[model samples]
Target: MRTFEYRLRPTKAQEQALMRTLLASRKMYNACLEDLITHYKETGKYLHLYEQDKHHGKEAHPDLPAVLVDTTLKRLHRSFTNFFRGLKEGRKIGFPRFKGATAWNTIQFRDAANCLDNGRFKAPLQCGGRMRVIVHRPLEGTFKFARIVLRPSGWYLQCVCETPPHPLLKKENAVGLDMGIRYLVADSNGHIIDNPKHARKTAKRLAHAQRNLARCKKGSHRRKKAKKKVARLHEHIANQRKDTLHKASRSYVDGYQTIAVEDLQVSNMVRNHCLAFVIADASWGMFRQYLEAKAESAGRQVIAVRPHYTSQTCSQCGESVEKSLSVRTHVCPFCGYIADRDENAARNILQRGLQVLARTGPSSSRREGPEQSGESPSVLKREAAGL
Candidate 1:
């Protein structure tokens, strides 16, 4: 499934209806969350989705469409599912919270069949009229659902569609990636993508907007305008980051047949006080996500190798060479080999990924610890003691 988003040109009445629908969905979400908390506290058991739906009955929301209401309830249920799944996987995750009006900005329609499409689409709501859509590109396959998202700039319509899979392209080139704070990505071939630092670059503008917002009185028109300015700056920064990542990842996927990258635990990595902000700004997680998605569609392979010792171990000699973060160049003590630290790490990652592919084949290859599947017992023991 793929999603295509377009800017919506809603009429004044349509805009009001959309806002009302979003507000109604937020209230419903809060109500369901409250029900769960009350039920859990009173009975010491969670209120499941179906049970909650029964309580809501067959009554339709005043201004919201039935499809929107149902979809919102289902989304709330999915949040619980994810929260519980995270707990089961020994991950620290917060429980679902009641959403305020500001928090809930999206309203979805589960069924695309109900929507009437001509030049514009008519949504199912009492006040919802036909809204003009800007289709920048043609949508493929069957439309599964639609979601209306309210952003700082304007409203957007996101259409989810099920697309047919095409045959994968065959290629001979394989590359590895090393993500860093200074550079966005360093490939095995020594190509480095400089980090754009979108947020840092726009820091002054954001700071000024924030200061303006702080000076304005709460609940005043000036405050609302100031808040919008701050939000728009943030949105711009996010868009810039996303666009840069997409281009970088797309280039790799298009050029390489096989791609190797570190299986970084970004959530855990962010706990380090010194590098947390830098790591978050790099957006390594999103880059990996984009790479994987592109690789999947292109019939390429992405190998997530163990990150441990990749930077410390010499790619030329396969010997451990201790280094600190400040050391940009890698110098191997055993073989007198030298290279950029990130480049060396990328080479090691590529070697490890190739070995993994040879052992398990590309189809079965996945993220795993070297000790669990590769590396002899003696090697593991030696590495444990830094022998």
Candidate 2:
């Protein structure tokens, strides 16, 4: 299934209505959670939606609208189903909990029939006529779903549709990548791509906007305007980062049939206070996600290798060399080889990826190997395969 996301431009009144809808949804979710807990405590059994609906539908809570009450109950049912599924799979608790003020701001609604195809997307409210939506991408598949999300900038709709599985491409060449903060990516062929540092470049503008936002009074008109200005700055930074990632990922995918990258623990990396900003700004997680989706569409294979000792082990000599983060150059005493630290790491990543592909056999007719300096047949195959 292909998913499409659209930027929504709601009028003032429509925006208020949307906010109210979100608030109502949040309230309903919390109330349902409370009811479930109460029922479980009293009867030693969980109450199903039909049973909860009978009780809630009969009692009138003056604060909540009838529509909101119904929606919330259904949401609770879905949440319960998900919670049980997660539990069965040894996942952490997935119950819907009460959202506080800070959390409430992030609350959103995911429901069916809210998609563009249903024509029910434009809802009438006090602030405006029908809500207008701009479709960013076309949807594909049978079942359609929509998510009303709250972002730092504003609200958006993500429409998702399920479709047939994509066909695999018939290509053989593969490349492995080692991503790092200093160098954006290193490949098996000793190629190193420099980090753009998009966030660092815009830090000054972001700081200025943030200072303005901090000085404004809470809930005041000036404060809201200042907050939006800061948010816009953030959006710009994010866009710049995403643009760089798209270009890099596209180039890699277009050049190789199979792409291998290390499965990094970004959350663990962020735990280090000193490296948190750099890690977050690098956005390796988001880059990998983009690569996966793009590769899927292009019928290429994306492999993730275990990251253990990838940097410390010498690719040529197969010997361990301890080096601190401060080391910029890799000098392997065992092999008498010298290279830039990042370039060496990238070559190791490429070798690991090729090893994995070799085990799977050639899914595509193209062979995964090093580019020969003067091999005409190999060069022709690489060109025909778009590598």
Candidate 3:
């Protein structure tokens, strides 16, 4: 399934209706959460969705439709489920919490049949009622569901649709990418894409807006206006960052049949306070996500290999050469080879990815039979490990 998002233009009355529905949904979410906590505290046992529904199944929220209520409750239940899963996986995750009025901004409609009529939005008409939508591109495939999202800029609709893969003919069959804050992407092909620091560019504007917001009296009209301005600035930066990532990922998918990249633990990487802000602005994670998603629809492959020593090991000599993060170039003593640090890393990533593909993926022909090969990869691995 793929998602397509479009701009929504709702009238003032419709906008009020949308706000009211969102508020109602938030209230319902909070009420359900309170009940769960109360029940758990009293019984010392947790209540799942069904049990909670049984307890308050008869309650009616006029503004919140039945479909909307189910979606909201399921979302709350899913949050708890995720929290438990995170605990089991030893991840840092907090328990489910109540949603504030501003926090809850999405309403999903489960029954999504004929969501569009003559290229106009039609789903969940009771709330916003057939609003004007820009269908910039033709949507292909069966409609699944519609998600209404309220952003600082305006309202938007996300349509999830089931579509078959549209494969493109491959050229430049494989390449690896080294992602970094300085350069967004450096490929094994020696191509480099500079990182566009959207947040940094707009930092001054954001700071000024935040200062204005802080000076405004709390709950005053000026405060609200200032807050919205800050939010819009933030949204603009996010959109700019997302746009760059999408274009870069799309180019990679279109140019390469197989894309290899480091399986970076971004959560761990962000712990370094000095580089955290820059790293977040770089958005390496979003780039990978876009690459994988686009590759899937295009019938291409994405290989994520371990990022342990790609930067330290020599791509030409296969020898370990440790260097500080400050080093911008790689010079191998053993092989007398020299190259850009990120390019060497990209080469190493591609080589490692090909090795992985040989071992596991059926698409690769790198693995030869025992009768045809001189030695197996396991023999070399064992020799390298001195085992």
Candidate 4:
């Protein structure tokens, strides 16, 4: 399923109704949590999820839509499931906490075939009228469900639809992408996109707004306004980064039939204090997410090869050559191969991806390694796959 977002323009009364809906949903969620704890502790048994909805749902808070109440209960159920799973697996777990006014800012609606039609939302309130919606681009496929989210800027409606695939013509083009700090992407095709460093560019303004927020008295109007200002600045940076990544991922999906990229261990990489700031700014994980989603829709393939010695091995003859981060140029002492460091890595990634395809075709999505072993993700794959 694909999702489309639109801006909602509600009249004063309609806006008030929406706010009430949001508040009721939040309260309903918290009430469900309280009941879950009480029921679990009292009888050590799981309560019927929908049965409790009769007490805390529309019967108790009639202002909220029934669909909204149902969705809220499901959210609580999912959280409890995850919490229990974490405990079973011996992982860190935190019990779901009650959300405050600011934290609870979304209300979801289902069975809304009429909720978004002809660029208008049929008002959910008893007062019947249509709410203006800015449909910047026409939505595709059948409307499934929608969620109205409150942000620092304004209210937004996220509409999920069952979109059909729009596949491109078959082609044989393939490229490998090496993610880096200096450049956001370096491809096997010898192309590069520079990292814009969105957060670093707006650092001064963010710091100033944060300072103002800290100086204001607690729970004062000025402090709230300052907090919003800081939030807007952050939102701006995020929007910029998202836009760039979308464009880059779209360009690749349109041009290449197959895309290869290293399965980077970003969580492990960020442990170094010196490079943490820049690495977070790169947002490699976000880029990969966009790549995979777009690729799936476009009927293209994306292969994630292990990233062990891609930068150290010679792409030409597969000779292992040790190198440090300071070395920007890769000089292969064995094969006399010479290329830019990231470019060589990209080439190596492409080679590994092809080998994987030869072994298992283009349908493998698991990380290129065994489930558990005393080996790194890369070396294990290489030794097992004989690559």
- The TM-score leader among the candidates is 1
lDDT of 2 at 119: 31
**Per-residue alpha-carbon lDDT of candidate 4 for residues 288-326, written as tens digits (9 for 90 to 100):** 888988888888888887777788889999989887666
| lDDT comparing candidate 1 with the true structure | 0.78
- Give the backbone clash total of model 1: 0
Better of 2 and 4 by TM-score: 4
Which digits, one per residue and each the tens of the lDDT, describe model 1 over residues 1-387?
Answer: 888888889888989888887787898888888888889999999888787787665464656666766787899989999899989987777799888767888877778754437647667755376788887788888888888889999998888888876536688879989876667789899999986766566767887888899999989999999999999998887787888899998898889888999877665542333322443434877998888888787888888888778888999989899876667899888999989998998999999889878888776126755454332222212322331
For model 2, the run of ten residues with the poorest summed lDDT:
372-381
Model 3 misplaced regions, further than 4 Å: 55-59, 123-126, 197-200, 214-220, 271-282, 363-387
Q: Estimate each model's TM-score.
A: 0.89, 0.75, 0.86, 0.86
Shift of residue 303 alpha carbon in model 2, Å: 1.4
Where in model 1 is the C-alpha error above 4 Å? 58-60, 114-116, 197-200, 215-220, 271-282, 369-387
Clash pairs (backbone) in predicted model 1: none
What tens digits encode model 2's per-residue C-alpha lDDT throughout 111-159?
5534464333534232133555676556677645655566777776667
Error of 2 at 173 (Å): 1.3
Question: Global lDDT of each model?
Answer: 0.78, 0.66, 0.78, 0.77
RMSD of 1: 5.2
Between candidates 2 and 3, the one scoring higher on TM-score is: 3
